[model samples]
Target: MSQQEHQAHSLKQHWRDIFQQGLQHSQSRYHAEDFEIEMAFYGDLITHYQSQRALALAEVQKKLPQPLVKLWQRANLANYYTRSAATTQIPLLPIYRPQQKASLKHQLWWRSLRFKDEIYKDLMIRLNRHPQLHLKVLQHFLTESYLYLCNDHFMQAVHQRLQQRFAHSSEPAIVVAHSLGTVIAYNFLRANPQFAVQRLITLASPLPYQAMKKSFKQRVARPTSLLGDWYNFCADEDFFATQPLDRAPFNFQPQIINQTIHTFVDKPHEIIGYLQHPQVIRAITLE
Candidate 1:
């Protein structure tokens, strides 16, 4: 193999080893049931690492000069919104535009104040203590969010995937999207109003957050393409889904059926936990 190809292969092996080691460490920390969940989460990342890594690296290379700046913008847009006007003493804007003049220290302080919940606290601790492992996990989520929101190339790819998936099919399909997938699914259905989606099941969705709502370029409303109800299931402990999609911006015709659930797992944001919920199962399986 060429030097560049060989180097890329070696780097992939290195990350595989790191993720495996992290998985072993997680196994020791959790009980049997929870370990299964952790294993699946990390294992999927490991198994699909090559493809995901390629996609992420391609997007990063294209935006090499300003990738970090883009990440900061996406992070603020995704996490810096208030739940409601009543909850915070300070008036938080629905939209977040980074203050280019703000000092790094000021920005860090601002983020800390906004993200005071236990989930963010726990994640911050993990980020500090186990930077490699935890940062990898955070990177996976953030990369997907950043690319889809900021990169036109990535958006075109998403549209292509949707078209390819449903090109020949005329029947309305049920969509069950988890985490960042929920954001993509919502945008796709909204942008293409002819997709004929029967129902949208958003698990651990971030749609309720003003941060997510404001990030959308289009008007944030229910997808006119949806012919059935929109069932949103959020775990009580899932940091991304602290609120349900029943408020002003999200509230519209064919109202969203928001259900808050509790997934008593070590990682509440994991898709497996959300998928395994009895209510979610029924929502996906029921006619």
Candidate 2:
């Protein structure tokens, strides 16, 4: 590889190490801390992540509009992120059992079938055989609010932290988000349009289009123009994001850039398997 590519790869590995270390530290501290201490720790993490986010954003803004950049830096937006709401636990609903058991032949056939092959076999066949399953899957896609609030808070905290780190830049900011973090990035930019977020990169986001259904349309119908130059990378086999992007419930057009990361031979989502794939590392470091 060229020197630049090697450096980029090194940077990606470094970030992965940092992320892993953060996760380890968090778990250890979480177990040792009292409720108050735990809260304090979370506060610190929020601050740190936000700062990193802001720096990254400012780097992106050099290529964007000034008015938009100003919106990203407003104090009101930061306050929105710092404010806390009451914490309440929402219980997971029980899964319904089918009254009739699968026939031995049917069960055996399904047991032998490959899940990936089945996933793309035929939408109609999958829908017909497991109608309720499909509906429930879609329902799960729509039920993001439980995590949305927390994500929103995270984005604000990141912005505050970023603002301090990248304070010198006058250009519009860029937001790079991965997985569930995409939702947080979206809300942050949407709520702070003045901040001039020039680009948004969403890696493995599960934004359900179905959330915009008649029953829930009102919640997200407002015109919020935060989604610009949005690049959405999805591993075709990353079942986690398949439905969300395809089923999102809004009229907003996202400038989605698709990436296909090859899955492991037999086991996908396993940590080692995920690690072996360069895309996971590449996504974060963008080498």
- What would the per-residue lDDT of candidate 2 be over residues 153-261, giving only the tens digit for each residue? 5435545654453354466544555544555455545555456655555655545433312122125532254434555565544444454343334444553555565
**Whole-model Cα lDDT of every candidate shown, in order:** 0.55, 0.39
Candidate 1 regions off by >4 Å? 1-141, 213-215
Off by over 4 Å in 2: 1-169, 209-228, 244-248, 258-260, 263-287
Model 1 steric clash pairs: none
Per-residue accuracy of model 1 over 106-125 as CA lDDT, tens digit each: 77865564454454635433
| Candidate 2, position 173, lDDT | 47
Q: What is the TM-score of each candidate against the true structure?
A: 0.54, 0.40
Cα-based lDDT at residue 271, candidate 2:
26
